[model samples]
Target: MRGDVLVVHETEKPPESWAAAVLLTEHPDPSADAPPWQEEAIRLLRDRWAGPGRLVVFAGGRRGFPSAAPEHAEGWASDWRGTALAHSDVVICRSPGGGCPAGVAGWGAGHDSGRIVLRVPARPAAGERPEPGGPEVADAVTAALAHLGTGAERTGVQRQVPLPIWRTDSFQRWYGAQRAAGNTLLAARPVWSLRIGADRRLVFYWALHAVVHVTAEDRVKDNEVVISRPDIATAVLYVPGATIDDTEIVLVREFRTAASTPDGFVHELPGGSSMRTTDPRSLVACEVREETGLHLDPGRFRAHGSRQLTAPMSAHHAHLFSAEITPEELEVIRGLADVPQGVAAESERTWPEIATFRRIRTERLVDWATLGLIVQALTDRGHPLP
Candidate 1:
């Protein structure tokens, strides 16, 4: 995103009451000493804001940058030396009175694009200060962009909750791939989008808003936002014994906040998102090993089928698979119940759970969907039970 920047001084008065503003094309010498506020502004300009757009500074009375005099003018001038306001697409400034000043509405009068006023704390300790280049500022800028319908094709209303900014490259790459595959409902442009949550290197949840062109004469506004996530790979590890009572299904017990169970833990098949591997079979095997600490070949995983977990809320599917194991392998997996498994860096922890097939099928210890997967895998493998 090409971001325009406006640096405003801390004023008790509102923005419209300001008498002068200055447009700066060149940054002041880095070696020159500056006051605290100027120092913070310079940091934001250098690290946070990106521009081929205008850089404007605003203040009241005679106050201005140390190197430049205030251009006493009405509203924002169209020109200051060689700099022009016409090139600006967005305006960004800090909230000097703890909240955005009401007069900021006047600043938006001349521009069709969005304006963002970063919030500041009402009272900070004598030495403590908020980081202008931190995640909070990034969130504010992205929210402003989404609300203003900034994207390849601005369509419909870009509805989105304030969320962490997706790394620009990541969002662009994903969007480009979707367009190339013609999977975005013949979208003309993005109305808005945001990443709801994510892992270290991947997004777990996402939302999008767009406009679709179904025909030459018809333009349909896509709903406010459509949410989705990456598909999951899951598998049931079956261990055979001499009788039905002895037979077991290997599962993992992990703390999932989304789980509605009593303990907020899910006791289900070993499965997870494709984080460590992109190959579906490999992902199944990888999740099994990470969650159960039981090594198994990817080739051992038999793909039964895949289905959408939630049709209305997400477009992602769950790829179902199963693996057969020897009784000795079951013992080895059982031994891992006391030992924590899963990717530690990602804050995951799981314990192996080996339950009798009969009990798991009748007791409702797991979700109905998981029970369905188990039954489907067993029946497909020619081990149908009564």
Candidate 2:
């Protein structure tokens, strides 16, 4: 992201309207900072800070070290100097105000690419120009700004949400090789996308720094089908029925605010967002243990299709996997079902409410689709469904 500079001053009465004063700066030297999407930032901020004042400070000097501004207070320290050396600098609360603090707030984005971009340099199309990023790119850019605590209201930027993307076989192979070789790619994470809908309707998603192209004919009349997070993993753990003669799996009954279940809790597989944080198999293993206290080896999880549907509203692609249930794992489930989770106050996490669905066949709670997936997986692994 390119460097950014925001200077806010606290004023009294007539200038109290000016308390929301914002000063934007620009450096003449092109290489001094990353290219900025100033136009988009201006439009978004104009709507955000609609007032009697807007000033753009163009540094005719360059980008570099600071020269003392005798006109201003002695202690004033700005992030970007009026020279060609320093990039992405911020100056906040250096001078004193009438009754309030001299500076209310300030924002400075690092020299990355301005927090959002048309495309990342990592995933190379090699001579192929990326599709023209529309408002979606701007939305991501502005959202990244908001996430830096740049707005007046100080809205919380949610980072937990997954950024969605459609990966090619070659790209997946590359990513896998990188991971196996312990080569962490920087161009990943906090996705960026250009979502174009019907009637040229455009909405942006900043999940990762990736892009998806759409032609005009791809638009629908009044309906626009956009998947927020398409690629994910959902797995079912089969365990034993009442007598424990054979093994069965566990299906989670979760009440998600984003998903609408008849009784709030839907019968869904326990899984995690398949990201770099955890390997897909490991994530499934963690989910199984967290939801059912079952400890299964990651290698046991068999992946099937890449188009598993967790919910209709979230029409993203996901992986479906299943594992054989062991008798020892069944005993572990019984042991953890009522185990005390000590205290939920550590990470300020909500105390978990344990629910028991044991003593029931895996097929009893699993939907046909999920049940079918598990059966297929078992058969493919040489263990036919009973």
Q: Which one is best on lDDT? A: 1
Q: Each candidate: what lDDT?
A: 0.54, 0.37
Cα lDDT over the full model 2:
0.37
Clashing pairs in 1: 153-189, 153-190
lDDT of 1 at 346: 72
Candidate with top TM-score is: 1
Q: How many clashing residue pairs appear in each of the predictions shown? A: 2, 36
Deviation in Å, model 1, residue 261 alpha carbon:
1.3
Q: What TM-score, computed on C-alpha atoms, does each candidate reach?
A: 0.53, 0.40
Q: Please report the TM-score between candidate 2 and the true structure.
A: 0.40
Residue 128 lDDT in candidate 1: 86
Off by over 4 Å in 1: 1-202, 209-225, 241-246, 275-277
